[model samples]
Target: MTTMEPQGGFSYSEADFRRVQDIARREAGINLPISKRSLVFSRVSRRIRATGRASFRDYLDYVSGREGQDELKELICVLTTNVTQFFREKSHFEHLEAHVLPQLGEKLRAGGRGRLWSAACSTGQEPWSMAMSVMAELPDALRMDLKILATDINHAVVETGRIGQYPAEEVRSVPQRWQDAYMEPMEMEQVSMAREIRRLVTFRPLNLNREWPFKGQFDVIFCRNVVIYFDDETRNALWKRLADRLVPGGFLYVGHSERVDCIRECHLEAVAPTIYMKKG
Candidate 1:
């Protein structure tokens, strides 16, 4: 393979790029095509510099070795995008308020348990928004047997969610009514979620590619926008796994651009755009 001469103090070759594609797929279920070659180079190049590796090959070798487990986590973090905000994809939240929450409210009020999972929750906004939605519909949710589980592959972002603090500007996207009820002002132009809201959510590190630790199912799951990184096989398998984790009549919300291709096989039916319900 002809190696391209050093573009930014490191020689990157076609073989190196293929290796990256394979490692990303195997480690994180991310599929990188040839178009992402430049992106891979740009992002992974920083790792080469940070780790003092002389070339792309050297950095790749080090990260592939047993001693590179920690760096491997960093590579996955750098490769995956984590852009999210409060009530993003407003339509999903709207549907949750208009339809899903009502059903869940009844179940919780009747002394039944309820669970909501933000499976790809980034920086806590998704689950916090979920908490706000629950509070709006069911003020006594904190007293009920209901909880929201927020998890992500990135440790740093999970910590951010656990802390329940965000830049003031970021919280501005939250509805003013909920904001006043659930947000507390802090110094340094930051805002903290009130203990009431924070208490409703649990943040932890989770990789969707791996086996889940918990065995229980969910009433509603928000797993939007993350599966686009995966290839067809991995994406389909993930969809099935997520479906298996949904209780009958539960809802699965995905990104606008994604579709649940295995709906029939998974016993799910499309209820709305980007929304599917597990059939009883």
Candidate 2:
């Protein structure tokens, strides 16, 4: 890749884009194809301005330098696309209500705990939506040791989820019953998740490409949408980790565009569109 002159006051080149893409792939397991050059330039351009760097090359050098660990995190935050909403994919939630939760409820009644994971929980919507669905079926879920772990690699978004607030428009897709039972009005045209719903979720920062610290197995895991940004190898590795982290007969929910065919070795059987079950 040859170095090209600056275009549109953004000093970028093929080399710079490749460097950024390589870093993103290695550091975050996110694949940045050449088609995303413009997107990368736009997202990374902001960091150049923020860091007062002369160009993308200089910015990349700084971020890859010895003192760039924190800056690298900022870069990852900016690069990740977090497009999420309440009940974004209705089918998964429908399945949760219809089949998964009832099975999980039986386990809970048998003195076993129920654990759900929103693996790519962007700004609280997914996990909160999961909580609402679970509550509708199991009203005493929180009292019965039901736990929801919502995790994301983006620090900013994880913090936003921890606050449990969203614009009113953002929560419109949420069912009326859920809104009535689990939403509290907030200023700025927003609403907050009710304590009962919020209490069930614990938000944390996690990188799916890295080792997971928890040894607990989840009864259902919602890892939707985000994996599309990763390459096949990274995606498959994550699928295995998800399989390992799930309890026997646990459900795995993926994005509409993602498939779990590559994880056959994990013994995860596809039970429905974008839903997989770990075989005992």
For candidate 2, list the clashing residue pairs, or say none: none
Q: TM-score for model 2?
A: 0.96
Residue-level lDDT of model 2, residues 138-201, one tens digit each, is 9878778889999999989999999998899888888787898999988889899998788899
Query: Considering summed lDDT, which 10 consecutive residues are worst modelled in model 2?
Result: 1-10
What are the Cα lDDT values of the candidates? 0.91, 0.90
Candidate 1's error at 155, in angstroms?
1.7
Query: Can you give the TM-score per candidate against the true fold?
Result: 0.95, 0.96
Estimate, for each residue in 66-180, the C-alpha lDDT of model 1 and write its tens digit: 9988998888887888899999999999999999988898998899999999999988899999899999998999899999999999888999999999999988888788889
Best by TM-score: 2
- Location of the lowest summed lDDT over 10 successive residues in candidate 1: 2-11
